[model samples]
Target: MAKYANGHLPARDRFAHWRELLSGTHAPMTLSSERADDFLARQHVVALGEVTVWPAVFPPVTFRRTRELIRRSDPESYHLTLMLRGSGIADWRHRTLRTSPGTFHTSDSSRPVEIRSWAERGRIMMIGVEVPKAVLPLPRRLADRAVGLPVPDDQGVGALLSHTLRRLVRDLPEYRLADGPRLGEVVAGLTATVLGQVTDGESALPPHVHRETTALRVRAFVEQHLGDPDLSPALIAAAHHISTSYLHRVFRAEDVTVGTLIRQRRLRRARAELADPRWDGVPIQTIAARWCFTGAQFSRSFRTAYDMTPGEYRGLRGGDGPGV
Candidate 1:
């Protein structure tokens, strides 16, 4: 992983360093800022096989990929920019689109484009992937449709991709070189599904890919909604637009039922809290309620799952995982 930022530097040199950093991370582009102080930004990037996962923060600036610039320095890559903060407008492939937090858009380096983050645009945070054009297995037509198009990251494949990318960025430093291939599979699978769905070509994805990838999405949804007591197999299936039977069929491959998975997850979270020093003074009932458990029911499940009561567990292990 690589990290870059300008701090404790003269205002005049900040913009210069920012430009150099941007060009080094991405393809060279025309960058400018009207603010005398420019903007403080930081970038953290990791290369996982052919995919590059980058998370960054920046202030308002205007960036343009003019025809001349593209012709002279195109990288022949596509960047899927997931907006984490603020908003901006991108003019690419004859389209002007507005993007906000929790949404993403693709930037094709081969094409001329203009993106503006105005003075009033506020701070920005985003995660983007750099995938070489030649290595992207997605169909050209489908890929083109997603270029410069705003893709929703709040649900479905988009949500899965969003979560996976953020997690990868957070955990990148801990990964080994041999894990690159596995990471590549994750990036490709989620990227393909998101693109296919956005372009109305979801049928083009093979059955195994769609099923396995959607299974991950199901898991993501479960983790995200675990706090809701109403979370159930039927609701989970509905959220992903699959039937309850289909949900069970796929989950069977994991050797666990939906109810079992939910229970285990809730129990695990409750256990974490019980062991956490920060929650040391918190009532056992409150911790149970946080994970949708209650009273004796919570204690019984806690004992059954861990062979000890919540109070005993907290007294014993204090903040840790599984082994407790």
Candidate 2:
């Protein structure tokens, strides 16, 4: 989620700003607060393709998910929120939970709930994960057990999950647009691991399934960081805590090397950008720099792959370019 600087809104527009931002980020609902006139909030959003990790700070407010809201809207995915600062009291699924920093909780958009939040000193801070129910690798009944339940950050699976989410947010600078979907897979897998444990140990994914799932996570991480320029077999392996040899071996099974895929993806992105009218004002050198390519190298590689200079290709508007 990108940051919505509500503090910048005018007094007359503060309510509208906050209202739109909250509803857009989470589920559709109503917001109320005596201090709406002075509400201050912002968020950093990490969209991992299917999973979305959102960290936000807000002033005191009441967010309600009413029966009418539920009835009128299509069901959204489940959300897991870990409070980093401030606190909240939630009424959901016939239970009330006092949420504080170092505590996490789950909620279903399909259900009716009320959350009254209070600031710690002067602000409320939290991290939220949105996971589609269909992607979770668990039975529906077992997954339902987690909704509305508070899991402490230092205990059980919550500890690992909370830690992972924080790390992901902190490392946002290292991620790219392609990484969103891969990270989404990682979030879903971690969530499934936690939810699976909550129901019963035996209910967790089988060992083989777990390995396959983890492999997908590793691949996603690599793809997400592919544009780093420093991205290499060793770097990719180190980031995921795996051996370089293992990385090579695994990618071999896919019939392509990591380096080859990175080069191809970079070229594809560059080609797509060059062909699009939106990048028409962007200079060829500027575009090359972004993808870690120099003027000569980018020209040579692109011509070999697509048979045209970057500028010539751009001029063609993606049709009937130079062939000789």
Candidate 3:
């Protein structure tokens, strides 16, 4: 019999092939079951019908059903089960998990495991993300040790990733064709984050991956407009298709500010020119203008920052200084 009686297939196809396969109509259940099996195989578990994901402080899942799922699916993915309702017990080769609300349990797909729910009858939310065995960074020797480790939902990168995933699932259908690439990236990042947590920081899965992926674009935009005297927050934001507030937020996260960082960089370049003996009498205004600085204002900020006026600092450095 199919475990998922309500959600496994669309309601319209409830009476046709889907229901027939669940009833075990065909022999060996191999050929006829291939479709359902293939679909289930993609994920680590399956049900004869639909599975309702509820939002309680904690989540719940059927222990017996969970065991059946493990035995039947035997996949290569990872499962993170968060108990939200009542309670439950997870039995593995040698350990037992007494699950409660707000607590989580993890398991690998290649093992034999059992999950038993508490007597009160509870429900839980299960998050599943697949990682190929061959690509797992940690040695098998230590991989299993992380199983059943409770993921605290309060803080840290894990919490951030968990929150993002929960929000994504809640708005799953909104991810359509136009958003496929972004959705895929989000999925990859979230999966990496979970893996890193499971492996105890042995993985390089963090939000920085996304940041780096787009860093080149940011750098290019800033460089191309290096000569704009008004190359300020509003200009940068408009060029990058983001809000000025968001641009500032990104710079702040990097331990700098949009305007301050740009000004510092510009001053550094200007100082290099001032030190060049070739431009010995280039005029302070000329040097500042060459670097896209606002003449007098640049000199003021530069002096305030470096503790000396531009010309004075220039003469002290004796030309031939830094480069591009």
lDDT of each: 0.80, 0.75, 0.52
In model 2, residue pairs whose N, Cα or C atoms come closer than 3 Å (at least 3 residues apart or on different chains), thus clashing, are 1-45, 1-46, 48-180, 49-180, 49-181
| lDDT per residue as tens, model 3, 250-324 | 666567777776777788877777777887767778878877866778778887988988867876866433321
Sort the predicted structures by lDDT, highest score first. Answer: 1, 2, 3
Best by TM-score: 1
Per-residue CA lDDT of model 1 for 1-324, tens digit only, reads 788888667777887788887776778887887653756788887777887878988887788878887778877887888888878889875799887777888888888888876434566788878887776667767877778777898876787888888888777768898998668767876887788888898787667677678678778878889999999999998887889999999888778899989989999998888767888777888888888987788888889988988878877864343332
- Answer with 1 or 3, whichever has the higher TM-score: 1
Candidate 2 weakest ten by summed lDDT: 315-324
Candidate 2 local lDDT, 203-292, one digit each (tens):
566554355444555555655675687977788778767788877777665677878777777888788878777777778777776788
TM-score, structure 2 vs. true: 0.64
Model 1: residues with Cα > 4 Å off, grouped in runs: 8-11, 36-39, 119-122, 170-181, 227-235, 252-257, 276-309, 317-324
Candidate 1 local Cα displacement, residue 25, angstroms: 2.2
**Full candidate order by TM-score, most accurate first:** 1, 2, 3
Better candidate by lDDT, 1 or 3: 1
TM-score of each: 0.80, 0.64, 0.42
lDDT at position 93, candidate 3:
56
List of clashing residue pairs for candidate 1: 275-319
Overall local distance difference test of candidate 1: 0.80
**Residue 44 in candidate 2 has what lDDT?**
74
